[model samples]
Structures are given as structure tokens and as C-alpha cells.
Target: MTELGYAQAPAVAAREGVPRPCLGCGAPMAVTADAQLHADATLTCGFCGRSETMPAQAAAQDRYLRLRLMQVRRAREGMEAPLKTYEMMRASGVFALIVFGAQGGWMLWGAFTTADKGSAVFGMLGAAGMMGVILANFGMMRAFRKLIKPLQQARPPAAPGLAARCRSCGGDLPPVRSTHATCAFCGANNFLDNAAAHDVNALLTAEQQDYKVRASGGKPGDNTIYQRPAHAFYVWGAAGAAVTFVVGVVLVLVLV
Candidate 1:
């Protein structure tokens, strides 16, 4: 037995017989059985015939496959209602802010001009409407933050170059500008027809993993709520509420 990249030498010949090729190097592989009855594997290069072991490499490959499967699941979850809710909340926040600002201006003007009691009533109604809009904006912003919080908490997707694999040969290829490439070994020109496929795959994987984690009771924590940017309307609402209260007070004082 001989040490390879990351595998240790096996102790005895395996009962299961030798594997024809090394899983990692594609060299002729041998199997050995240990006292514990576990089979440890090693490889001898076909051309060089260099003795090498790769049990650790095999274990790592298994882990990678599991991780990729998890990622696919997460991506599917991301395409669901949670994403839509986030978009809706974001749009509503913007709409509420705009409506509040426009109506606030009108209300302020009505407060100053009123020939009759009805005009004064209209002014009070406008003030209430503006307050409602401001509150609505705050609610929308809060909802938006909740929706995107999971995405923000989840790990980012793998870099494009790292995620991509050759479609035809299943080999890791260098980042190339051209989608079509001749495989160095197989002579397949369409080894990976879509260069962006890796990126898309990674994104989907991340989303799927995130969704599973979130569904399993993993959350971004309460701290994420405070991390969200304060909605502008919240500030405006506080200011408008204060101003309205003051103006009403002044009017009462002047009338008395």
C-alpha cells in the first residue's frame, strides 16, 4: 500500500477484490480489508503504475454530491410564495410613501384655508388620511424586510467558475468565454454549451438550500429586523403627526 494525494495505505488485500480503476485518478485501483472489515482502496496508475490511495478523496466526493442535492432543494423553495411576498411588500412600500407625501401636502394646505366649518372638517379628514398612509408605509417596509431576510441570511452562491462543470464529460473545465469548447480528451466541441449554466445552477442550489433551512426552523434571527433600513415614511409620519397635533392646538388657542 502506498500513500496518495490524501488517502492512507491499506493494511491487507480486500475480500471484495480489487477495483479496476481509481475513482479519482482513473488508474487501476486495489482494495484492502482492515481488521475492522472495512475496505480501504488504493490505486496504481495504469501508465505510470504508481501506487496511490484515495479513500479520503472518495469521502470528499460523497460530501460534495450531498451538498449539491441540498442546493437543488433550496432553489426550488426560493421560487415559491416567499419570493412573491417580498416583491409585493417592496412595491407597496414605495406606493404608500408616494401617496402619503402627495396627500400630506394637500392636507397642510386645507388646514390654512376654510371659509366654513365643512372646510375645517375636510382638513381634519385629510390629516387622518395622511397618517394612515404613513402607517401603511411602515407596515409594508416591515413585511418586505421579513420576506428578504432569509435570502440575506443564507450564504451566497458559489462563484461562477467554481460551480460550473463540463456537461459532456462531467469534468471541471476552466472558465471560458465561449460556450462551446472542444474537450481536451474527448474532442467534444459542445462540452458545455451554456457558459452561464453553472451560475444558474449555483443560484438555484443556494435558493433551495436556503428554503430548506428556513423551513426547518432556521431563521435569520430577530437581529435581522433591526438591520433593515428604516422606512422614510416612518420619519415623515412622526413629523406629520407632530405637526398636525401642534396646528390643532394652535387653532384651538387662537379661537379661544
Candidate 2:
């Protein structure tokens, strides 16, 4: 039962694959909540007869909304570099389409309409140069698509446990080294022994892996997320192509 005066179900969540080592005896600690639940709970070391108090929120780490929110923020911050790189690549593609597309259209127009043979030959050279630019731009886009593939699939590296929060009022707790903490807001005493802290830290570590996977552009359980910046390149590229075709039609009509 929680402090809210309701009967809570016994936790059947999957155990951390490796058993947490007992702080006292360096043996495997109990995996179930009844054996390891903190908040005035006791865990006796089966190997050494040593008793340890659990952390204040060890059993209820998932229920803390503040802690979960912090995890999300941390995951997004972890992917900041890749996300920024993708956006920069997308912007450069758009800039190239505008500048190169205009230059190419002008060169092709001059090649067709020039009266002097020398000027016409120069315009033809410019038109060839424009075709090369278009091909190079296509190749660059492909390279960028490959560049962000690794980034989108990248996972966050392991990090330290997040700062602990007060169980009663959700206030931040100073580095917890002892067996108890007094919440500044609610004045409720909380348990936070070394064994409990270890368990809680372990939970945070596992949750961070999932959080990072989702934040880096992939859905939960998915290996890759749909990268919007990369997708934008194709979308704008199509639009630019359509505009160039329309301009070509207009030029043909005017020149004929």
C-alpha cells in the first residue's frame, strides 16, 4: 500500500538481468519487491546475515513523474549534436536548389537565344557546367543521407544516475549517503540507505537506454526513427524540380 491509503499490487516487473550485488556481502541481492522494496523496507543479506535499509523511492522510481520528465530531457540533450547536424544539412540542400537552379536556368536560356557564335558557345559551356552542378548536387544529397544514417541509429552512452528527489513533496535531495532524508516541503522522513540507492541507480541506468533510443529519432522498440530533416531534403527537392519544369515550359513558349 502506498502513502495514499490504497492497496498496491505486488510488482511483477522484469528483473534487472543481472542481480544487484549485496552491499554487505558482495552476493546477489533479492530481485522481488517484497525482498528489496525501499521506504522503511528492510533487505536481509542471505549470504552474510547483514540487514540494509532500502532507498526512499526505490520501489516507486517509475511512478515519479518528475524523474521521468528529467530522463526525457536528458535523452534529448544527448542527441543534440546529431539533430543539429541533420538540420544544417537540410538547410544547405535548400540553399543549393535556389542558387544553382537559377544559375542553370539562365545559362540554358542564353545558350538557345544568343545571336553571336562565340557568346553562344560560352553559353553552351555554362549550360554544361549547370548540368554538372545538378548531378553533383544529387550526389551530395545521397552522401548526406548516408551521413545521418549512423547518427539516427546512434545510442546514448551510459551516464551516472540522476539526482534523487524527495518522495513526499518531490523536492530535490542533496547527495544521499545516509539512511534517511527529511523532505524540506512536507517534513516527511524518507529512507535512503546505500543498498536502496544502488537499486534505484540501476533502474535509472536501464531506463536511460530506452529513453535515448526513442529520443534519437526512433520509436519505442524501433531501431531507427524517421529522420524529419533528411525527409525534408527529398520533399524540397521535388518541389524545386517541379518549379524548374514550369520555368522551362515558360521559356520555351517565350523563345518560340
Candidate 3:
């Protein structure tokens, strides 16, 4: 669980270069400085064609965006830490179970073979208890995974640059405000290289391209046809292609 709090909204200032995840498509949406100055600004997602109007200086709106972004970043970081622990525990558990099985099997075999019925019963009970404990551990881990299942599924692929992601925690690095940018998700400080520092816009461009590829199924470009109001164009294009095929067939038949 992650919580985010914001201070009182200040006078409208030029706040640009902040990317918020879209509610409709989860793609990154840029909040322009225009949004800050104006009474209302419409944010349209480039990926899914979802548009929503946001008030420029409303206190509640200001708080909501900041809170939502903070929650997203914190939730991502929270799930990542536990997931790493779960992986390590799973590997150790597998090795522990293997050793337990081997030793328990031998102990039971020896007790049963010799004329020691009491020892055999004790060995059997111990083995059952150990197995029960191992199963319980696995069950708990399974539940933990299930708890964070939605986060895992919604996790976006890392953007294609060192500057685009945090060095420590693999979360998306926030825009560089200075020489070094502190990760919102993880507290690690990432120093931007000279090239990256000079070309901060490149990071946003890379992320937008990545989003286009995802939304367009590996074809990255203007994908408005997939969005509403443009679906008719796609239909018309298909119909035109069919008509062209029929026209070519008729031409070939007459010429032959």
C-alpha cells in the first residue's frame, strides 16, 4: 500500500515535462505548461485517443494528479522489493526441500529395516511435519504473488536507454531537473551523462516511440486509424483493397 500527500496548490506556474500515465491506455501523457496557465486544458492520449479535460488551477485537481502519480510510482517500487525476496526464497526452498526429502527418506528406511517400530513411527511424524512446513511456505509465497498480480501484469517494459530507467530499481526515471535526477520509485540518484543532459527531450521521444510500438503491435507510427473516429477510414481502406482485387481479376479475364 502506498500513500501520497500534496501541499496546498500554488499560483499557476509553468510546470512542463511531467509525464502522467493515461487512464485509458496507461501510456505516458505529457502535461504541458499550457495546462498550468489556462483555466482548462484537454489532454489527449497519443496512443488510445482518450481525451479528458483538466482544470488549470483547481486545488482538488492539482492534488489528484500528484497523488495518483505518487501512488503509481510507490506501488511499482513496493511490488518490486517483495518480488525479489520471493524469488530468492523460492530458490532456497527448492534446495531445502530436496535435502529434507533425501535425509527423511534414508532415516525412514533405516528405522523400518531394523526392529525399531517406535523409531520408525517417530521418523514418519517428523517427515510429515517438515513437509507440511515446506508446503506452507510455498503457499504463502503463492498468495503474495497473487496479491501483486495486477501490478505485474500492468508493468510496462523498460524504455530503451540508461537515462530512461533508474540504475538501482529498474523503475522509470523521472525527468532530470538538474545534473542528477532522483528516482521517485526508488531513492537512488542517477547522474545524467553529458549526452543525455544535452538531449533530455530524447528520453521522452524514446518513451513515446515505445508506446507507439506497443499500441500499434510493433508498427510504430501515426496509429490514429485504431482509435475512434478513424475506424471508418480503416474500414474504407479495406473495402477499397477488395474492390481493387476484383477490378484486376476482371481486367485479366478480358485481356486473356
Candidate 4:
């Protein structure tokens, strides 16, 4: 024994496999968690009564996982953005329609009553500008449709990853290492010393997976969620419809 009831050998041996050789004795070493589940591995030598602590284990050193997290994209959470947009465009469309109508009336009065070219030209240009606004709003409505479609989709949660690998063999490892694991490729023992980052990450993954499975509207294992339409869709739709009405009126007057 070295200092306490521990062995005099290094905490970990240079070579290894699951049930790695203990430092003091040639017996296999295994890692286990304590009662709290908040600590590192309590490495115990099976042959000799020796113990030591280990660092947090990492996983998937070579390969990478792009995990799409599960989360509910609330419909009302950011409604303000689209709502404000709708209000502005709708107001502009209404103002343009009124201006265009008044200008058209003035231009018609000037044309029949007298050849006052200044008033006629002014009215014509003013009406043209209002018409342009109505057309621009139409284009905005089309783009807004594309934006709202995704809001109708079930949004997955944000996904984040970490750099991980087996401490002993530098091999890929599973997320959960509670009881610990032995590598099949290198026969190296893996520990489940839950570090802060890894513990939270694994817990989140498990919870999200379960949530997706439960929220699914299909079969037992199907993944689905309620997708809400964006508020912007309604807003833009109202503005677009308003502009279309005014444009139709202007066209009728021109044709007449």
C-alpha cells in the first residue's frame, strides 16, 4: 500500500482493458459510482483491497453526432415580430389606396373640366406612386408566405455537442457510463464518472427523446409534435388582401 489503503502504483496503468489490471496486484480493476451519483469513479481492485479515483470519461472521439434536440416551439412566444410587421404594412396599404383614389378623381375632374396640365400631371404621378406601393406590398406577402411555412413545422430544440473519447483506449464510448463499460475493440475499461457537462448533456438527451416519443401523434415510437402557424402569416395575409382590393379598384378606374 502507498499512502492510505491505496496501491503504490500509478492511478491508471499504461495498458488496459475492462477489468484492467490493478496497480498493486495483478487483479482486474473496476470502476463504480458512490451513493450520491455526483462523483468520479471509485476504482477498486478485485484481487487486492486497493482503491483510487478517476477523471470523467469521454466518448465518440473519432465520430461526431449531430443531435436535433426536442423542444416545443411555442406559437405565441415571438408573435410580436410578425404582428408589428403586419400592422405597418396594412397601414401603408390603406394609406396608399386612399391617396390613389383621391388622385384618380382629381385627375378625372381636370381632364373633363379644363386642360389644366399642371394639376393633371401631378395627379397622374401621385396615383402612379400609390400604385407602386400596392405592388410592393404584394411582393412582401409572397415572401412572408415562405417565412410562415416553417412556423407551421414542429421545431426541434437546439443541439449542442462536445469533444469526447475513451480515456483509456481513446475509443468511442456510449453516453451513459453509469455502471461503466468495457471496450470491445481494445478491451479497455471505461468509467462513468459523470462530469458536469456530460451529465447534463446525457440527461437532456434522454428526456428529449422520451418527450418526442410521447408527443408523437402517430404510433408508439413515432416522433411528432403540434406545430402552430406563425402570427406573421395572418398579418401579411391581411395586408396583401387589403392591397389587392385597392389595386383592383385602381385598375377598374383606369379601364373605365
Candidate 5:
């Protein structure tokens, strides 16, 4: 028995239904049985738009429908990649170093000033301020790195075929013989002529699935579907910047 508690081979076969040829492209329609017994059956064709209901004894049809659903689930999961730890650490480290250097410069200038006792007190306060900034910057860097590390480490799915289903028309776009090729359905130019092909993979990492789904499409499920990690990065970066700016203002007012 597999993890779902059914025999793997037969259960899979039971889930998959009969194949029907597509009317548009002659591609085969894959069908599967819905888990809910006695429920109305549905069919989904990966290559064309064709669906039909099956009679009660349509075991083969059920299997085909289930297989299609399985494929979709896998594809959706594959779209979301993972975050890399090294990349997160590197970004955070750079931010920390920059903030630390700036604070250090401010402190060094305070040491050289020749003023009265009040000036000396202010100088000491400035030194303390620099230390506080250094610590705060380091903390911020650590927090940001931790938050995004899991996202960076996610693995992407295998690349799709040259001809992919168009988001707008749901039609396949075949590759051009030449480097410059335009999508037949939508007239969108394929990036073949460019240095790299366009990646249609999902943008969010596996760990951020829940957050991405919620923030983006408001999907009720726990999984997230982001088109790109950079989107998440921008959102996080903006929030972090706003917080840092507010903290810096408070500190400057208190110290100066």
C-alpha cells in the first residue's frame, strides 16, 4: 500500500480513466476517477478543451481524470522554488557592513572635536550611538537573512517544453525555426533571440508557499504561488527599510 493507504499500481490505474483524442490537435485526453464515489465525473484534457461526464461503471474514465489532477498538482508544486541560505547570508552581510561602516565614520569624527564639557558629554553619547547602530544593523541583517533563507534554498521544477500553454489563450506556442520567434496565439515574442530563454517557472520558494499564496491571490489553501522571488524580496525589503528608517530617526533625535 502506498502512503495514501491503497495499493500503488492498481490505485493509480483506478484513478486514471480512458484516453480520448482531442478535437483541435488530436492529442490524447487523459482522464481519472474522482475520489468521491457516486459523484458526477469530470474530464480534463491537457492538450485541448474537451470534458465529458462518464456513466457509473466508467472506471477507466476515473483513472484518466485522476491522472490529470495529479499532473496539475505536481506542476503547481514544481513552480515554487526554494530559497538559498548562502544568497540570503550574502545580502544580509552586505547590508550590515554598509550600515556599520557609516556608523563607525560618525564616531571617528566625534573623537576629533575639541569643545567644552558639554561637547565631551555629547561625544560620549555619539560613541554610544554608534555602538547601538552597529548592534541594531547586525540584528536586522540576521533577522532578514533568517526570514529569506528558506525561500532561497527551494528547488525549481524541470523546464517546460518549448511549446507551452499560453496564459492568455491556453494554446500551445511552438518554437520558431529562427532565433526570433513570436507566439502564434498572442504575438508575444519568444525570448529565443535573447541571451537566455524566459523561465516560466513559479517565483516563490516552497517554504514561502503559504505566505505567497495569501499575499498574492488570496488562495484559501496553505500553499503559495508566486511568479518570482524578486517580488517577495521587494516587498520584504520595503518593509524592512521603513522599519530601519523609523528606528534611525528615533535614535538620531535621542542622541543628538
Candidate 6:
């Protein structure tokens, strides 16, 4: 993940001073970050448009490895963000609901037991306000289904492949996607290459590119499907809070 940035601006372009040949046409594949700071790449022929995604590990050397890492990291974070938020919401909502139920019940009992008519009415209104808090919190938790299911689906299904073997000593390589994974057994920088492996790495690399485009700041590039709105959780939270407030106020007004 870290090594991808240590290479260059368009780091994954060269290896041993020979341009990384396009697998399709043997022409040099030039990698770039355009005006949108997106990693521009295609493992395809310029003339024939024959493209294929190769594993970053098998494809290029030190230079291009960095670019691949950048895309992978960005995509991973983007895809995982919704899942994290959903977990937080689910945990917090349950805790709050437990407390809310106890408090609301106590308030309603106070309203019921009060002798004075005016005081009893105000107490009932206060109980309603408490109920508002519970209901709003509950609704927000339910609303999270819109994001939760999508996030769950978006998670890349894991495809277990053979661990990349160290090129120098045949030791098992744990970090399959990296260009600089040092083998514990032999201390050799070895990883899985595209040729000797399944297309899983290439599929991940392509997905990461799309995620990186969406994760990128500023106007989205051509590849971006939908820009992730900043502070989405906060916006939804504020909306829920506003609902609680409005419901409480309306209940009090109607009672008085």
C-alpha cells in the first residue's frame, strides 16, 4: 500500500529504463494523473483498443507499484466507509433506545400520577417530548437500511488464491498485491505476478481505479459513478435531530 507512492507522479510507467510494454501491442503504456488527479491507465492497445487489467504485482516494477497501491487504498477506504457508519449507528441506536425507553416510561408515569390538571397536562406533554426523542432515534436506525444493504453488497467478494511465492527463494509471499513484500523465510522482495496468477488481482485493480476516481476530491473524473457526499452521516443526523425537536414542540403546543 505504501510503496505505490514512493515511486513517481505517474510512478508505474517504467522498469529498468525500458517502458513497460503493453501486453497487447508491445507499445509503451504511459500512466498519468490528469487534471482531476486520477490515475490514467489502460493495459490495452492504442490502435486496436484491446485492453486487459493486469495485477499491479505482476505488471510493473517499483515505479508502477506505487500507483496501484494508491488506487487500491482509496477504493478500499471508500467501499468500507458505509459499513463502518452502519455499525456505529446500529450500536449507538440500540444503547440510546434502551435508555430512552426507561426515561420515557418514568416521565409518562409522572404525568399520570400528577393531581393538578395544568401540571398533569404539562407533564404529559413532557412525556410526549421524551417519546419524540425515542421515535426519531428509532426511525433513523431504520433509515440506515438504505445505505446498509448497498454497502454490504458493494463489499468485494473474497476470492482466495494461492499465496505468491518468493521469486528468489520460493518462500510463500503473504502480501500478494505489493511489489515490495519481503518474504519472512528468505527476506526476498517477492509477490504474485499477473502471468502466474488468477485474474482476481486484475479485477481488484480495476475496481480500485473506479473507487479512486470517486474518492478523489474536486469535480469527479469520467470514471466516477457518484461522488461520495462529504458529511453524509452528519447531514442525516442533523435531520433526525430536527425531527425530534419539531415533534416535541408540536406536542407541547397542542397540549397547552
TM-score of 6: 0.34
By TM-score, the better pick of 2 and 4 is: 4
Candidate 3 residue spans exceeding 4 A from truth: 1-80, 155-256
Ten-residue stretch with the least lDDT total in model 3: 5-14
lDDT of 2 by residue, 66-151 (tens): 23434443444444434554556646655665665566557556656653344443344434444444544564466445653433
Report the lDDT of model 1 for residue 221. 44
Error of 4 at 68 (Å): 19
Pairs in clash, predicted candidate 3: none
Against the reference, the lDDT scores of all candidates come to 0.45, 0.46, 0.48, 0.44, 0.42, 0.46
Best by TM-score: 6
Minimum summed lDDT over a 10-residue window in model 6 is located at 222-231
List the candidates' TM-scores in order.
0.31, 0.28, 0.31, 0.29, 0.24, 0.34
Can you write out model 5's per-residue Cα lDDT over 66-185, one digit (the tens) per residue? 454444434533443332332454466556555645554455355344423344344444344444444444554455445533332222222443344332223344544664443332
Query: What's the residue-level lDDT of 145 in candidate 5?
Result: 47
In model 4, where do residues sit more than 4 Å from their true spots? 1-83, 153-256
| Native-to-model Cα distance after best TM-score fit, residue 176 in candidate 5, in Å | 18
Residue-level lDDT of model 3, residues 24-85, one tens digit each, is 88997643323332234456678998876656454346445544444555655553543444
> What tens digits encode model 1's per-residue C-alpha lDDT throughout 96-134?
656755665565466555434444444554555566556
* Distance from true location, Cα of 69 in model 1, Å: 9.8
Number of backbone-clashing residue pairs for each candidate, in the order shown: 7, 3, 0, 4, 32, 6
Displacement of residue 113 (Cα, Å) in model 4 is 3.5
Best-fitting candidate, measured by lDDT? 3
Error of 2 at 110 (Å): 2.3
Candidate 3 all-Cα RMSD: 23.7
RMSD, one per candidate, in order: 17.5, 17.6, 23.7, 19.8, 15.6, 15.5
